[model samples]
Target: MTASKLYILDTNVLLHDPKCLYEFKEQDIAIPMTVLEELDDIKDRKKNVSSEARHAIRAIDHILSGASTSAQITKGVPIKQNALNGVDTRLGKLSIFPDHELTMRQGFLPNDHNKDNLIINCALHLQATNPHREIILVTKDINMRLKALGAGLLKVEDYRTDQLVSDIELLPAGHYQMEGNFWEHVTDVKSYQEGKYTFHQIDRSILPNTYPAEYIYDESDGFAARVISVDEETITLQDLNHERIMQQNCWGIEPINIQQAFAMQAVLDPSIDLAILNGAAGSGKTLVALACALEMVIEDKQFNKIIVTRSTPPVAEDIGFLPGTEEEKMTPWLSAIHDNLEAMHEQDERPQSSVKYAIEKANIQFKSLNFIRGRSIQDALVLIDEAQNLTPSQLKTIITRCGKGSKMICLGNLAQIDSNYLTPLTSGLTYIVERFKDYPGAANVHLEGIFRSELAEYAEEHL
Candidate 1:
């Protein structure tokens, strides 16, 4: 029989996913004392981080409650499948290493008070004490992993159990290109018509594994349509009215490319309750979303108002605190929204105060995500920007808040995820795009062309 490995987890792993404790199958898990201290410090933080920390602490306490004595906890307590809610049946042990023997390592300083270095030293201590067992350190921090490997810890790995994809390149583009003879094959499919739209039904065998609202284009001919329905036997597609959609202006903004046009169609379609827009930094995600929301809420009167929110993960140094109302406090974070709104007003040739009047008369609200829980939003256009900074759990909380007669637009650039716990593959925006691909009334678009400026495009490409 193969011996069980000892997996030492870092604080970030627990913060990233509280349920990570049960992910390792039949492996003895170790929690260093420093990790527990860090969790204690973070448990009283903001909603997202605090909730994760609390859950991790609860899981540890529950596991330890099954043990009778401190000796069992120190030596190791068996982690039963029943204790972990039947997630895994692999019998392993869980222990807390409360102390580490002081040792002199070549790379890391002995007197260094850094938490990362201390965690590395704890893993080193475990390896030395348990020569027979394979010891590994699991962390989401890339630099910490490198430091551990440099200190002669051979086994170091990122916690990837919850990661849906290994690389960002493997993420879905939300569209597909049909074969050269696609139009020729389309003649054989059944055709029908809906209100102001034409529909075609093709055998599922012909286009296997396609999703609703996924764009399918024929390069041979200038033909494109969005998948409207899919089933066991056939897929139904709605012919895209690109000319009409592009020619129509939304709050003084018009689609500049096919990608942008597709995004506009999805956002403007009353049938699609959810739309996800992803692209490079200069791809005009916020601009397109705001334009659609303004047109719908103000001009068309399709929705009651526009509600804007975003994840507040800092890019560099975090400002300690700001003194103001909630909306005033969020000004720094929502500057992109203000910038886009100003640009729209300029394009419309409206006076500067007209922007303020539109905001007041249209009943636009800027909200902090922290207070979004336990509230129901109805008959509104909810725009969540910078969605890549959110975790899958946090995203769920926000999405579920949408009530009847509501539409949501999620916009983000996966390459610019500011949260330390998230990556392109694990971000909430990516999660929603992949999970909702097959769901009806859901659509996604990846805008490729950068419209901000030539300099911005050059910086994105080369810098």
Candidate 2:
């Protein structure tokens, strides 16, 4: 009989995702004896991760509590077990389930370092006796995975519990293959625009001219989108309401020169769902996104809200205490977002129901980044400002928060990474762009103008 396959889930995977136990439906995941030890310590610490780690520890144990007999353990499926027997799970030719206690220990006491080594060693030891069994260690920490590899154990990044499919194959996970003469097939953009359209195999890194709009061949049913109207500064679409929709099609939110137009249109393209803006301060990343979102929320009524948040991550340290209502907690985090909103209001006419009218007429809901959990923000326009400060996992949570009839714009300067948890290339926003580039429903726009002042762009370039 073949030995059952074993997947050794690492501590970081559980910390990143509390539901890691359910990800690998194919194998029985053994909590590395070492990982259980480390988790015990982390469980007691007064940190954001303590309760979650503790919960995962408890959850894993609960799943496998029924296993008792050695004969029952090795022959059938693990019965979806999660046990942490301090003693090794194996005994000479016989199996001792979670109840087996360690009489003499050869490893660490589940302290951080000993814990990691123990988990890795457990897999190595398991491989020795169960020569036919496949053992894989899964983790989110690159360093931990590297360590396991150095110790001669196979390892994989834990992505099963994550909403973001890590760099999956470029082909459509699902696609909308529209027939040729597809544009001609549709009598009018409005007539057959009820369902959403997805353009497959979009390459964000390619030059603009290379885009294949004519081949927009897919008719997938997902968050529905449409091409309502197109202009130099905007391409408007309608939601289920049959209302007018507008996204930034102009070169800039309010461009001062012709050069800003191309970049702005790229930024506004609803088809282009991602972008990278790398100019120094005084650039228009915030304004352009806000303007586009505003246009969608007010002018178009495409969504019910204009949600803006920032990562405000400590490149190393924690941000100072955030206090007050959701809006208040966001005060410290959204200075850039506030500045742009204030600028937009500065030019407003205060016309009856004007600023108030757009928000009131459109029924816009606003909230901070730190306060966006446990809510399904469906059919909304979300702008994740200061995206460079977010980790890849953080961005995934935010993007997954998008409900039906929603569009998310992640705008940031790669040169400005403030999250201690991530770097420019590794920041959550860039990771999503790089990872999701092939999906037809998404697009990428890289904006390069510094509209605040040419001096800012000059310093960014020459200095």
Q: Which candidate is the best by TM-score?
A: 1
lDDT for model 2 comes to: 0.53
Model 1: residue 383 alpha-carbon error in angstroms: 1.0
Q: List TM-score per model, in order.
A: 0.92, 0.55
Query: Which candidate comes out best when scored by lDDT?
Result: 1
Q: Residues 116-231, candidate 2: write the lDDT tens digits.
A: 55566666665555677777777656676777677666544544444443442332211123443333333333233335633222222221222211112223311223233333
Poorest 10 consecutive residues of model 2 by lDDT? Answer: 91-100
So what's the TM-score on candidate 2? 0.55
The 0-to-1 C-alpha lDDT of every candidate, in the order given, reads 0.84, 0.53
CA lDDT, candidate 2, residue 390 = 64
